[model samples]
Target chain A: MKRRLLLVSNSTLHGGGYLQHCQQQIQDFFGKNVKRILFVPYALHDRDAYTKTARDKFKTLGYEVDSVHETPDPVDAVRKAEGIFIGGGNTFRLLKALYDSKLVTEIRKRVLEDGIPYMGSSAGTNVSTISINTTNDMPIVYPPTFAAIGLVPFNINPHFLDADPNSKHMGETREQRIVQYHEELDTPCVLGLREGSMLLVEGNKATLLGSTKARLFQRGKQTTEHDPGSDLSFLLTEAQ
Target chain B: MKRRLLLVSNSTLHGGGYLQHCQQQIQDFFGKNVKRILFVPYALHDRDAYTKTARDKFKTLGYEVDSVHETPDPVDAVRKAEGIFIGGGNTFRLLKALYDSKLVTEIRKRVLEDGIPYMGSSAGTNVSTISINTTNDMPIVYPPTFAAIGLVPFNINPHFLDADPNSKHMGETREQRIVQYHEELDTPCVLGLREGSMLLVEGNKATLLGSTKARLFQRGKQTTEHDPGSDLSFLLTEAQ
Candidate 1:
């Protein structure tokens, strides 16, 4: 697999500035070779504002951001882009727009085949998996399907939180929700990416980035937590 | 409009027994004419256990519970049911099961025309609305569509929580997610049913029941909060 993905849990940490926590990793990931990156702002409602945020952020990192919404042909823009970054908002809205613009396949090919670096924050990270079934966002809109880019073999649960037993909230916690998913399907495992954390995959070798620990949920298996710099390369390949 | 719905936020409130807080209202809604109430326990994985929980609780309220999952013919169960109660779990799983069993149209017809007393908690309450778009549940499984039973004129955001201003979590607040839904479509409104609360609809009147307040979100209108006993009948009617 010739895939390079920086799947982030959240764009901004609790008290940190926007993408300030993951600045160095993002800069080093895109590097100098990828001078221009295409930005997908469909996850959010205001594309103009989202694009401006990405433009300013990337500008500081020494890269130019060309928003796909501004282009008449998104597929063509994707084909010619050096790198791609999808800012997060609502997962359903983002996936619906991806299907509406017919950019899923093009973007997948660019990342998996052409090896263009792909960075996803929150909802963007959710859509990069086999399905967006594990996302915490409201449906808001119905996509053509829950099927996503499948850039990775498993589903990604971004901004994942553990259950607080003493809490008054009666609704099932994030862990319980993932358990329900496991009850229905067994094939694609789910990775619960904690806040402030991101997963970086460089071809066959994948590593868990950031200070937070990530929990992996595989059917019929005990949930395992991985620390930062731990090898998650096995996630890049599906279990037969 | 012959819709009779008891759409609740959470089945159990903090420090309360299961369905304990809303016991009297549940009994009153069904009344003496209804004997055996069919239970849709498809929301949870263990149908038998879910059915037992529902059966034991309903028995104390003077009703017999027959689970739809236990019946060989689920469609027939809905057709012959005197009253219906949908136990809550994962909203996506419940909706997917409803679509899989070909019960969406049947359930809608039964409730809309037959006017049989219907009760929903959490996920169940979510599907009773115009769509499951406003639900807080994860899409563990993809339903045929986000279009739900449409038992009411608006969408229901079950177990609605107010944003804790002091919290540091970076995910979109409950209020922001509803705002995003409004930005996309202007038709159906959204009703945020807070925990310990439920909406009681009888014929033409829909009242907010319980000790908590409910929030209403309509496009181009100020967000409104209604206290318990306030008439939300307007939500039962689609704005034209």
Candidate 2:
């Protein structure tokens, strides 16, 4: 239960550069304790390019960062890193890479047992939850399963967009998709993290943070919207 | 391969009733040969209600339909069916149900070996392709794998939408998602079935049908838009 995580709904907000929207939050969360960050860039196609972008951003935020893909042993990279940040891309691809590289358990151990701070955005945030079942991403590639890092107790749906009352699209709305998820699984809770929204978890306490509102959904219960400073401790205590 | 499929992009179009937009294509695909349709209502939660809706719609078009859930042995129902139709809801839920009930092989035999007409919409159309890797639905549940009926040589992306240039959403557009699929997979081809569009496949022949245009994407190639009445027999011959 000693989890310390900074889960972001999106990497870059609209009309902004990469990680520009939440620079101060990210820096404050990591603080001076984390000198270097181990970056996972497997979510995108070009691992080197993705790594360079993340490395540069973290460097700008006053931290030295290296990508796991650059290391000969990824699990070893996780074992020795001071901090970790998995960037946003396709969830399935990211999870598959995690499983393939055997970094899932190592990262879990480092964050929970070793007490290193973990950061994630979009697809990264989706995988840090109990499962990737609520992701807005297409099943472009299927991993071995939908199982992901169980860092937190509840599921996270990042980049969550509300249904537009003016549009007439035939596809299911984001709310309807989460409703269907609740109907299908015994999963206890799912948090809809809108763009520019984020969550900070420290041990037993969970706090909603960012510029937008977050949504809380439970099985067979009405969903409620939460403001930036709302306490989401109920989700951590609920059944998974 | 005697695969006969009427793959629809969506069940309903903007401002249209259930299955109202593509009623004629469905009627022509099944023809007078299929006296009764054995509907797979597993994609939806309320199978009975879903069946009733489909039954009523097909009844108006001069065909009798019964749901697989209403029957005791769903496998037997597929074995003895004149035609089969799987409605849209959640792709993960539908594929998991299909795998759980052991109907994937049965339905494949009926559609391929027996030459019974088959119809699918949205999620249904996704599972009918080589894999459910290109589906637009959220993965609400975990199936055994991404493997599907493989009734066709390529994958189908149902309810496909182009990226709105003016919109400032950071989420991957439908095109970007498909592009990512090509990047991660050796998947030979994927067809983006826009809303109100359909595809008809019969014995080594596949043709674009319905009102809207379809977009085609191949690995490491430029995407091309195809209009209604365009020949897509190339898909049937591509490497899967």
Candidate 3:
């Protein structure tokens, strides 16, 4: 079975309700077959509050949400989940929690082999890539390793922002940091998903979703912008 | 013997030459007694280029610069050095190289035990703290541990900037990220060292040196601002 994934750049936009804009996309991706979603709220600091927020959001979309934290066995929950949803928060904490629960391999197997639909936003989207090396979050905690689920070929830098032309700040811009990453690690392109943007994957077909353009970065090459409807499926086969 | 440290937030200002703004402080930190200094260029991508830059800058300040990478025995060079300097680059790379060369312990002993004057900028300054947890650089590579030299009691977030009130970016501000860090690990305080700022340490006395104010963050406490020339020696004793 081919895999399906919805990688969102952020859960809430400025002055927007939680996952409000992406509700239609969420409904379209899962269809009517996925009646229940096993939510992973590990990225959040307050897991109970995060789970409740997600539960309320999914309920409005006509689906029952069961958070993995409330489950007796998270691994078993993933094994039987019709779909999985990982919310956004600190990427380090989320990755550490995933490792601590030993859900890395199980999630990969469920999504890649079993064809269970998977969805993640922000830090959630960050961990769906090959590694969490490109995250913008502070290293509040160190994980055993930088490796992630590797469901996608390239790394995702969610909540990507363009440099302010009039700013006086001397810190590196997001583009410069991504360029530095390429300078150190030659392979693996970085996809900069701006706010209100997302990537949709179905089998081998990957498409850019939402209104904003996504920026793509590779070593020794100029960054290119892709429009919302453009096909990014080629990225799947580029990984070596 | 008392340990002496000069932790600079950046190597250069917006329109200035490398180390141009901090030359006087560099000279004042290492008096006429120090004839030669050892440079650690491992943080940069091009060691030779970075070393030459440091050598040129130090020469103008009347001190001979010898890079550890050029020495046949780096450990021996660190042991006999009068002063040590670490240039700015990616913090993760610098810490990893320090571990790879087994220079962490040697450098620590030389600076903290023997009282050899130590200086570092940007990534260099980030590693001088207890951990590289508050750095703004991308995690291009994973180090064996986030554990650094622990020369200072608190972590330093170098090149820190305040939020732009007019900006529409949805990403977390520098202050917010540091606050999140405290929420996870509450004990250690985070000092937001703006560009052009440096911390001068002599044993237990630490003074904020520069023309701008530095922001300090601690868990459950309001963020405090300290002006230039203010005494921050109290932070040195707050480690427990």
Q: What TM-score does each of the candidates earn?
A: 0.98, 0.98, 0.96
The C-alpha stretches of model 2 lying farther than 4 A from their native spots are A238-240
The DockQ for candidate 3, computed on C-alphas, is 0.71
Chain A TM per prediction: 0.98, 0.97, 0.98
Q: Positional deviation of A23 in candidate 2, in angstroms?
A: 0.4
Per-residue alpha-carbon lDDT of candidate 2 for residues B9-118, written as tens digits (9 for 90 to 100)? 99999988999999989889889877899999889999988999999999999999988999999999999999999999998899999999999999999899989999
Q: In candidate 2, residue A82 scores what lDDT?
A: 88
User: What TM-score would you report for chain A in candidate 3?
Assistant: 0.98
Superposed Cα deviation of residue A50, candidate 2 (Å)? 0.5
Give the CAPRI class of candidate 1.
high
Cα displacement (Å) at residue B135, model 3: 0.7
Q: If you assessed candidate 3 against the hidden native complex, which CAPRI class would it receive?
A: medium
- Better model by lDDT: candidate 1 vs candidate 2: 1
For candidate 3, write residues A1-240 as lDDT tens digits: 478999999898777899997889999998999999999999878899999999999999999999999999999999999999999888998999999999999999999999999999999999999999899988888999989998987899999999878766777789988887887855598999999999999999999998799999977878899999899998888552
Candidate 1 root-mean-square deviation in Å: 1.1
Candidate 3 residue lDDT tens string, B1-240: 388999999998888898998889998999999999999998878899999999998998999999999999999999999999998888998999999888999999998899999999999999989999999988888999999998988999999998889766677788878877887855598889999899999999999998678999877778899999999998898553
